[model samples]
Target: MKRLISTLMIFAFALALFGECALVFEKYTTDTRIKPITREMIAAQIRIEEKLSEQTTVNTGEPHKSTPSRQDNGAWMLTLVNDKNPLPDAYKPILKSLSNGLQFDRRAIEQLNSMLSDARAQGLSPVVCSA
Candidate 1:
């Protein structure tokens, strides 16, 4: 009977602590006064940002053409791959495996190694989990 009572007491204490933590989390993480944003508001913000970016862009008086085979410098790093700007179906990146068994693009392997070396020099145990 005593054991059961003590177990019940512990369970009740844990439940109360969880509830208190949830309440505290909600109190600090949420603001109820702000109105929900509409799609029009987001679209307007995007337009404003686009206008700002266009104003800041400097044109070098040459039409920009995408080059595929040039991997000399970090020029290839500007290639953007996303859902809207998907890579060519036949496109394949030259991958180089690191010492820790993770593979990354060969073009940026030097930069990646330099970053890892810098991290290690700063006494950080930086392990590349994925490439």
Candidate 2:
């Protein structure tokens, strides 16, 4: 009987504590006041969306001609060359030697020469340490 009374007292205390917490939460909790959207605001949003759509359509009409992948005998600038995506065994880039005896891909030779020339003109001694 004593055990049953003590268990009931504990349960009642837990219930009272839960009720007190519920009251405190209700007192502190507040409903967020949402400002209703006006018709003018909706119209403005629609106009902005229309302008964005127009700009996107205008920009997308002209398709960009990008360099083809390795399959098309062309090299992609962002080609992934890792263990999983290794270059083909027969793949070789045409190399050109720079004035400093450094070799690089023939396609990049013009840009590399231009950069080196510019650096030299600026009195900056740029050396090609590595390809």
Give the candidate number with the greatest TM-score. 1
Q: What is the C-alpha RMSD of each candidate to the true structure, in Å?
A: 12.4, 15.1
* lDDT digits (tens) for residues 20-76 of candidate 2: 999988766753565569999999999999999888875656776444344644655
Model 1: per-residue Cα lDDT over 19-50, one tens digit each: 99999999867978876899999999999999
Off by over 4 Å in 2: 1-75
Candidate 1 TM-score over all chains jointly: 0.44
Model 1: lDDT of residue 10: 100
Model number with the top lDDT: 1
Query: What are the lDDT scores of the predictions, listed in order?
Result: 0.87, 0.82
Model 1 CA deviation exceeding 4 Å by range? 1-74
